[model samples]
Target: MRQIEYFVAVAETQSFGAAAQSLAVTQPSLSKQIQALEADLGVVLFERTSRRVSLTPQGRALLPDAQRVLRQARRFRNKARSLGFDTDIRLVAGVLPSIGAYFMPRMIERLRQEMPGLKLSFVEGSSSELARQLVQGELDFVLASETDRTDLARRDLFTETLWLCSTPEDPVMQSDAPATLSDLKGRTLLTLSPEFHLNAIVARLAAQAGATLSTEYRGASLDAIRQIAANGPEVGVLPSLYALGEAIRDPHFKVRRLLGYDAEHPVVFYTRTSSPLQALNARLADIIILEKQAIRAERAPQFQV
Candidate 1:
């Protein structure tokens, strides 16, 4: 563990003195630990210079695996500390912005009630961005709708309805009132950017409708897309949660369903195939599943699209 800690500190700081200071140890002690580690592995982990320390090619190759080991060691330390006077259990959780705004509060409250010792940190990003971060070990788990479950170990959390929203300030022609694929023929549509999950769905729908949807004012986040839709004649398709609560609250906004697309969108939580945070991730999933069950029982509409 001494060798592991020394290697990580040195790699991160790239200076022996800085690493030593960070670890609250003497420079000589840190150098000895790194030397012991290199000798045990039969590889030169780092090259020492008067000005700066640098990782050897071998060290660069081993950094990620070594970081995982160090992270696991820290998790063990936290688990041990849980039995002591220190009661905090730190965990990092990521989610797409829309769901974080709407569903997260309930799950967070339940999580706090169930695990008072746990301190959950939430990060918001596009699903693809979150997935990349999860793979890079920056996040323990992600709650998002667009992540590919086949490439990751994931659990379905909940599903929401989707809808197309436009401001009532600009009503559609009578032929387009009960909007269908044919009715969208000449209408210009404002959609979310490519980063959003619903963007692909909306694009496919437009293709089937033989309509060209312009994304010049597109945004990746649900909140931004809702705002764009609320401004004027722009039509933005969004999840039921945002369309209903934020976009619809304005009497100027009108909600319409996409003629030929799947109504239910599956939202999920994902973790890497091999992660040290499995137990913590599963605990969070249990809370999500319980909340999902309650929401489904009530049968409330999350989207009207």
Candidate 2:
């Protein structure tokens, strides 16, 4: 079981040293266990060079099963500990860019209140990358805006509306509201990088509006765009969820509902299809759904997706 755990950890971390640190073991022992597991399985699980380690094809094929075994082992241990012993659970959660800002703190607070002994770690990245990590078994649960169905089972966390946001001081903000994309033909826009779904939305919206939108800068960080919007004449397209606090507090920034932009940006909580975290995933999912609705109820009148 330790060998299986070690193998999965190595695969998930992509470095033996990092896996050892995470597992709280020495590198040599972790390597020994992984070697033993490879021998028992009769396959080379990883291609290790001096600088890095990568999974082999056979390793990729066996990774899901190996992860399942480790999860079961963990569950069994927890079940035993529940019988008058201590059952401490460690959870690794991945999150999308925008959702992490507000939702994460609330979720973490709730988790601490419910499970005082829980050990939590978080990783934030693009929704697609986070989804891929979920599929790869690197994360126990992921809060994401887009669901990647490859190897994950997702529960809808919430849906957020999107809008066009600009600095109040900008001349365009004073102009008549844009009913169509073409209204801002030569406007400079700030948005997420091309790899993110929001960037694609901005592109398509521009094409439809017959506007030649030029992105001054593109990145995954919403704060960066907000800063640019605050500093320059760039119009920003952002999720209403992210733009809310700024809009409310800053006199210079305002969000305008994008006409015909009603699309469900489905924030989902995802886990591996077969893992012991399923029950925990369900609990987290319930919390997310409830909290998301509460958030939307307060802001929905002013926001549109």
Candidate 3:
């Protein structure tokens, strides 16, 4: 491809020195490339003398096609840029299963429409596991809870509030207004297993609200808590996105934000400090932000209620 470019440059200028100058390369390098091109094609492409350089008959015959190839290549590049990726980029990304369950489906759909050439294979795990994988160079980036690891660079994507969730027939759903911390004072809160950062948050909120945090039946995932709630009366604390998913899926499901508590956690994207994919990871975060925003818009009524 480069040889063809140099060939065209020399053909246009009809001088080695001029072509080299136009290409910002040494004349010898340009001449070498042209010679190599001719060697590769098995044809003599130039008639050379001290004062002039002119194309041979064979060179003239191939010049038009070579120019056509270069034109097609340019069009290829432009079209790729128009589609949002000039060159294809593949990433093995890690996400927290909690968010992945609710948000990844929409995110992936939007990503396909916006950047078809950006390929991603998603891995789901606890935050610690994801961070370990990232540090060991197993993942391109991770979307999970914030971490203070000196070796990892963190970018704040968004903050999501927590909601207390249960089936509509639960005693706590008797009122349509937002629930108060007082309402949870005597209840047992179902929660994710201690491996999750959310478990600690749930423990803290339980302590503040005078509720019992159930450890005897810790859930392995957010969906596990939802399934557990389906057969029991225990309330589960869930992040806004996951709670929104449950509320939308079941007409009898109920979620209530705490009236006096600001229970939100910051989400982050983590990668190694010296990662070659810094810009690409930032773009991924931007897309996630947009997708989350669209979700917020779509569920604005649920949020408002």
Candidate 4:
């Protein structure tokens, strides 16, 4: 298990020094462990050059099995700890910045009220990063988009419609009509960094519309992209809740539904299939879905225009 841990750390970081620092061990110790593991398996696990380190085919094949073992071990430890006299529960969760920005406040409040004995911590990152953390057992569950991993359990939570947002003075906003995909032609589209699922969705929309996605202004969050869109010429692709929240408060921004484009982004909750916290995680997911549904119901009238 220790050797497998060392190998996984090195594989993930792609740098022995970085992996050693992350694991709080000396580089030589990590290297020795990995070397011993390779000897035991009788195969070279990594291709190490001066400039970079990459996993070999043998390592790639074993990586998922290693992660599964680690996840199960962690779950066993956690389960044992939960059998103590303390009835309190601790959960670590991950969420993408875009989803967190809109839903986190409400979700936190509800959790505090409903599950007072629960100790909750959250990490924010891109959807892919969140998924990675979940798979590695660092996170108990994740609120993110659907992932391709078959080892994780996923439940569809809700769908958020994507809207085109621009400064009020932009020609598309002034036209007194909903924007269409073709309306974006030759225009600049700004979005979150490519690691975000929303960015891929926006890029596809741009490609279909014959618009240019601006690589020069990749934003770290929805707010960052929204602020950039307020400067004009460049438009933003935003989720309905974010667009409505911003547009209602800031007269400078205008949001319109996109015509002839499928703009729904499905949000889902993910947990390891073998998680010991499955029951509690499902309850938490239910709370999130209920709150999200309530918000959507209340705000549905505002978006009708």
Q: What is the C-alpha lDDT of each candidate?
A: 0.73, 0.73, 0.81, 0.81
- Could you tell me the TM-score of candidate 1? 0.62
Q: What TM-score does candidate 2 reach?
A: 0.64
Tens-digit lDDT string for candidate 3 (92-114):
88888767788888887887887
> Where's the lowest-lDDT run of ten residues in candidate 2?
80-89
Give RMSD to native, each candidate: 14.4, 17.1, 4.4, 19.1
User: Which candidate model has the greater TM-score, 2 or 3?
Assistant: 3
Off by over 4 Å in 2: 1-87, 114-117, 147-149, 175-182, 213-215, 249-252, 262-264, 300-305
Deviation of model 1 at 200, angstroms: 0.9
Candidate 1 residues lying further than 4 Å off, grouped into runs, are: 1-87, 148-151, 169-183, 247-254, 293-305
TM of each candidate vs. truth: 0.62, 0.64, 0.76, 0.67
- Model 3 scores a TM of 0.76
Model 1 poorest 10 in a row by lDDT:
170-179
lDDT string for model 2 (146-233, tens) is: 5435667767666666566666776656653534565557776677887676776677776666554555776788888877876767
Best candidate (score: TM-score): 3
**Tens-digit lDDT track for model 1 on 21-126?**
9999999999988988999999999998888799999999988888999999889888775632225767687877666776678777877788777777888887
Least accurate stretch of 10 residues (summed lDDT) in model 4? 79-88
Q: Clash number for every model?
A: 4, 5, 0, 0
Candidate 4's C-alpha runs over 4 A off are 1-87, 175-177
